[model samples]
Target: MRPTFLPSLIVLAALLLCGCDAPVDHYPPNELYSLVVSTREMVSTQVAADDTTAVVEAWFGTPVQPRWPADQMSGSAAKALVRLDNLERAAGRVYADQDDLHFGLYNEHCVTCHGVSGGGNGPASLLQNPYPRDFRAGVFKWKSTARNARPTRDDLIKILQHGAAGSAMPTFRLIPEQDLEALVDYVIFLSVRGQFERELISGAVQELEYDEARPSDGLSLMSIVGGDEESEALSFARETLDRITDGWARADDAVIQVPPETVADAASIQRGREWFHSPKALCSGCHGQDGDHPLALQTNYDDWTTEFTSRIGITPSDREAVRPFRSAGALRPRIIVPRKLSDGVFRGGDDPQTVYRRLVTGIDGTPMPAVNVSDQPSATGLTSDQIWDIVHYVRSLGESE
Candidate 1:
């Protein structure tokens, strides 16, 4: 049976009202969601007159525009914009029709926390201990690929299917597969669009002319606004977009090639337990003696938490620009608590192969790092065979569950 309203949902509904005492049946008018592009302009002083802009130009190029009656934009940038528009259209249809069940399913029930822009600062995001992921940054923690590589489509779908344990992210196994597919596509669209927005700001800083007079304001988006420079910017943007898209496209090809599972004999499990405490694998460093390791410090942070805290007050001096409402007592940043792994469900994925990748790639943005595997026999570093043994041992913990 479908679940009734949940406590989290109630909190979300209150946030949606923004302190307004609105009736439950009062659904806000459905609005077409669009990317909230950053408006901060780049100063010429930030970019030297002869600075190498190939990187920025490649990634951010020209702003997205419409065809003919619309402004000019890079082909790739336009594609991203188009994809987002298409998704917005689809989501809007469901929202407008008041198909709350299907609409919630359509979005993986994420809009409440992720916001329509996919920015981490969703309305309800602030209420959650760890904010909902901001897709714009394009830095995913649970991925099998290299630290910098985009996550595979399957990587994303798996999270949707199983959800991230110990977090608000919930498994949508009951949702229709087609709905999940649409949600994934929409997420990717937001990510691409968000990345493009970042690049565009960076490109403007590097590629535009700097007038010393307006030191703080930097270059207006209109500066160096036409001719070959614009064309070059657009070309660069398209190339960069293609590269980013291609990375996601090729992620499946980069999966770690694991050998088939081996026999889980007592000896192999024992060996794994030994390796777990070894200096190299260092599983006990965080997982503790029996999986419940006491933290060295009271606060432990993951990548997102680290980034969010570091940028407070410093990145954008205007506090209002980042956070809108807050009491003085709430200003102190909250710290992320690392999971007690003894519980046995890996947040990334539960399968052996997924665990193997986690060992190799490390969870991005957290203290967890990729383990170095060497074929040579040593007191430190592990061989592929040794790593597999550890995997078996770890799985054994789950058997009790």
Candidate 2:
């Protein structure tokens, strides 16, 4: 207050120039600043060492490059690797871990029908006619080569891409190429691991059989043996296990050749329908006239149940109280009719081909009989083209429904 305005201004300017009482120095620095600096330094170091060869070496711990023959990658391997990369990128985009790839695919596409453990016991599986594949059994129906044989890798890929013609398996073409490839790899892993476990079980069984066959000349051997029936059963089980293991180990390379989509023709449907109504087939007896009757052949449930129960040793009351009920309704006498094409309840789930498969293969541990209209009376006890006709007729019913 005592100084003049010019002198005070000059003094303030000097303080600012000297960085005394400056606004920039008034506050404390952010704690995160140090972290940011450290992160930048680490990233710089990583970038300095980063390269394709380095990445490969870090992952595999080997200097070996992919063996691309003729200086070109094979179609299968190329496709597979591309799919893998695509999946990895997708995982990053979604902020998902590597394990999430398996979890996502399994929960979204597989577990809905195949069950959590691939046991084919998912809740939706009950509504499906042919049911989902039981991975535990390691049995695949469709293949590139023949019946009961392992499908080729290409065959599996084709099925994944195109899907089965007459089933609930929808085509997954919308999936990214990389995810598809990863899915295939995971499936292969499951199959390989399953096969290995099957082999191990078989080997164990064989060893038990061999031990049982060993001559028991001493008290020690006698002590090792159990009761007669138990010992004999253990030996037999072991032998069977060994035989199965050997067979699985020697299995041939299962590679499926992709055929044109036209391979699955409509002729099968036509054949399936004709077989459904044949006198010898007796499907009409249960399914009804023209497959439109309300009760599917107007089956008298009370009488049928009585006869069935008599033969099976299960009381009517016991059958009625069974869990996860299969009966259509809770009427006095339960009418478990053969599923018809026209029923409002679509048990087959929009797949006429699956219905055809169910017709031919039949459901395991169920009353449904396997009807193959293709075989001779003596051979398969069916006529040629009969199954195909039945399939065709069933497909036709879809329009009416």
Candidate 3:
């Protein structure tokens, strides 16, 4: 069965009956909506095929057709997909209530903008100024975990609860908690799937000489022909899946726990200012003197500009709001300019805990990196106290403004 927006509408009606206030309509454009519906049809057909293996192949298969003679669903690749799909199915059964709603929750609400494969290339993606997130790359802009780690579940949930301040992504706070959990699970599923697919493609292209032009390359698994190669390929696939899944599973374990609240006083603020200017943190490098200014041309591009401009036919000359998604398609490609910290408006909330998470997680997809400090001793990292001092300093920048 195909999914519909009626569930959202139903929720809206219930809200009205209860006198609860909430956003009734968060629908995307008709073109994007149609695209999602069609994509679901394709998925349903693939899943409904008599051969279950075909479902695995189609869902996890590479976008690039291999040119070489290859088994597209090699034994090892098949094993990996089977395992991952099991988890996906389990997540679906446990989190999502129905079949049609499985991954499409993320697809309709997210994929319409974030992309079916999480590559941030949804039909409407290019229209937005800051293009939607490309989950395939596994780089989230807002996180509360350590470097190169998955965003903590709470981190993902928080973003859903409170949407990003300057983006097209809306807050899903009003959705039932179960629905929210299902969506988050599906998103993580897509992220892991996309990342693994990337790894498999890279491995096949590099090691197996995947070529699409070869007659034997049609839907064949990237199988290993020799004994040594087979063992190596199987080992490699297992290791890759482990690493990818483990990174996500371990995110919560690595969350940066802030120490109890402390007063943002003169001494702490002074210390923070010093840290900001220090070569280690390099706050002054981009956010020059008092966070209001940058020292250079500041050409840093956000993920949107880096990935979508050329695809959408946007050019350097198009500066003002020239995109449809932004300013109703009137604005130009939006630049992901670094925030003016001195302005005192924190897009990710100004609360102390939020500030600490940003410092630790280093806003996922953006250029802003997490501070190199921990509560424990490290020759290279900072202690929690040090980060607190810096946080105080940043907070002060807004106050002084």
Model 1 TM-score (2 dp): 0.69
**lDDT, candidate 3, residue 164?**
75
Error of 3 at 10 (Å): 30
lDDT (Cα, tens digit) per residue for candidate 1, span 277-361? 7888888887777466735444555554334334332222235533421221112245555556667867898788888878877
Give me the candidate number with maximum TM-score: 1
TM-score of each: 0.69, 0.41, 0.62
Q: Largest lDDT belongs to which candidate?
A: 1
A best-first ranking of the candidates according to their lDDT comes to 1, 3, 2
**1 or 3, greater by lDDT:** 1
lDDT of 2 at 21: 16
Q: Which residue runs does candidate 1 get wrong by more than 4 Å?
A: 1-90, 96-108, 207-230, 294-300, 308-333, 398-401
lDDT of 3 by residue, 1-401 (tens): 23668788898989787542221122222222122222332322111121212222444442221111123333343233223332333231113446533433453366557654556666676677567776766777677666677787777878888887766778888766766775676567667665655555444334433333211322223332222344544455556666776677667787766677677899999988988888768777777887888543335555444433433444523555234333322223444566778878665667888798788777766667767775585656777777888899999887875
For each candidate, the alpha-carbon lDDT, in order, equals 0.57, 0.41, 0.56
Candidate 2 lDDT by residue in tens digits, 241-306: 334333333334433222222222467655555566676566666667667663423233332233
For candidate 1, what is the total of clashing residue pairs? 4
